[model samples]
Target: MKLWEIAHSRTGDKGNISNLSLIVYNMEDFKEVKEKITAEAVKKHFKDIVKGEVIRYELPQLGAFNFVMYDALGGGVTRSLSLDKHGKSLSSFLLNMEI
Candidate 1:
């Protein structure tokens, strides 16, 4: 199943770094997500766009995980000519990940 079936996401960006938070609807879903969603997987999923590291933070109390991707914006919003410079669309892309 897709991750979106049990979770939602929020995205933010600063410079070339993008932050994406995946929040599960139920605490019961956290363990599965935590086990399957690794920083390496995320980095691989976005390898074409991201040039640096992917760091993941586990928030068990909140039933969420935050991923910080470096060098991911093509540049900053001001310098990037890409339509989605802030990388907001990445959240939706990530939600499509299989569990």
Candidate 2:
């Protein structure tokens, strides 16, 4: 199942980094999400786009995970050539991943 079925996303961008927050609708699904989705998994999933590093921060109290991806915006939005690869769009792409 795709993560989107059980959760939604919020995003933030700074420099060439993309901060994606995956928040589960129900806390019951948090355990599965935490186990299946790792920093390595996320980095691999967005390997082509994220060039630096992917760091995952657990927010279990909120049933969320915040992923900090570096060099992900093609050298920041102002420097990116690709029209479609913005930080905002990455979250949508992430939702496409099957867990």
Which is the leading candidate under TM-score?
A: 1
Candidate 1 per-residue C-alpha lDDT over 1-99 given as tens digits, one digit per residue, 9 for 90 to 100: 999999999999999999999999999999999989999999999989999999999999999999999999988899889999888999999999999
User: What count of clashes does model 2 give?
Assistant: 0
Q: How far off is model 2, as Cα RMSD?
A: 1.1
Alpha-carbon deviation at 82 in model 2, angstroms: 2.0
User: Residue 8 in candidate 2 has what lDDT?
Assistant: 92
TM-score of each: 0.97, 0.95
User: What tens digits encode model 2's per-residue C-alpha lDDT throughout 1-99?
Assistant: 998999999778998889999999999999999999999999999989989989999999999999999889998878988785567888888887899
lDDT of 2 at 83: 83
Q: Could you give me the TM-score of model 1 versus the true structure?
A: 0.97
| Local distance difference test, candidate 1 | 0.95
Candidate 2 residue pairs in backbone clash: none
Worst 10 residues of 2 by lDDT: 81-90
